[model samples]
Target: MLDFTKSSAPAFQNLTPAQFAEGRQQPGAVLLDVRRPDEFAAGHLPGAFNLDVTASDFGPRVAALDKTRPTYVYCRSGARSASAAGQLATAGFAQVANLLGGVLDWPGALTTK
Candidate 1:
């Protein structure tokens, strides 16, 4: 259950690639990639789930996630993920993290599937 009547909204953190990697290893953490299917198929972080930000079901898909759990989001250039993070916060998500500069600034190894 989420308390949407709070006076203050939860602020999503802008984490660097290293910070984002470390945080994603935490228990109950969800790695969400907000890029298109084709972009995701090319390459993406290991274990990340695709939820295209441009899709019609984006809001509904995000709403289905556990709002209390920590969610890590990323996009091609960080723009879409940033927007997604804001949406999540507005939807009463308690914890949200955005990957600064998105995958473009990621210094970690990526996987293609």
Candidate 2:
């Protein structure tokens, strides 16, 4: 098992969809979808960007992200995002958060485009 408490960033902090909605309104905030490209194409949050953790380049992909900003990550349930969040933390991302229930509990306010 992973020792999230030892990390520089918090682990498993739950963020509601509304919180994610608000984050999108803030400067330097990014919503990161850790789902696969196909799942993302099927449906995702309006402004969320897809970066699959299963890919071999996941680390480099996240490394390309702005480490100075907060990133909101989510997956199908909560598993993948947790992993991705940990990676981000290890990669020196300052602030990171994860959606509690993924898109399964997004409350229908989410839209895909």
Candidate 3:
């Protein structure tokens, strides 16, 4: 029952495709694609960093990021990224945003792999 949504400045927010696109434009945004490497190789948002949420190294990789930064995460259709977003929130990321519909509902063209 850590209600991140109740905070005045919520630590975690599930965003619509539009909100996600706009928010990631802010300076210092960290975009994380929490999908398999092959899935990422197929296509992803520009500047996305690939890191498998299911991979054994997921925890370590996530730890390498600056916890105080604004972190946005996505997967093919949201499920995986939602989990990752929760993890990010629990791990003390200052701002953790999950793309609601993932890449399937992305507002812009994915970078060709």
Worst 10 residues of 1 by lDDT: 2-11
By lDDT, the candidates rank as 1, 3, 2
Candidate 2, 9-107: lDDT as tens digits: 545356787886676567888889999998898888878899999999999888888998888899888788988888888888888888878888787
lDDT of 1 by residue, 1-113 (tens): 87877857558999998899999999999999999999999999999999998999999988899999999999998999999998899999999999999999998888996
Model 3 stretches with alpha carbons more than 4 Å out? 1-11
TM-score for predicted model 3 compared with the true structure: 0.88
Global lDDT for candidate 1?
A: 0.93
Q: Which is better, 2 or 3, measured by lDDT?
A: 3
Q: Which segments of candidate 2 are over 4 A away from where they belong?
A: 1-12, 109-112
Which 10-residue span in candidate 2 carries the lowest summed lDDT? Answer: 5-14
1-113 per-residue lDDT for model 3 (tens digits): 67775754335899999999899999999999999999999999999999999999999889889998899999999999999998888777899999998999987899955
Best by TM-score: 1
Candidate 1 residue 6 C-alpha distance from true site, Å: 14
- Ranking under TM-score, best-scoring first? 1, 3, 2
Q: What is the lDDT of residue 15 in candidate 3?
A: 97
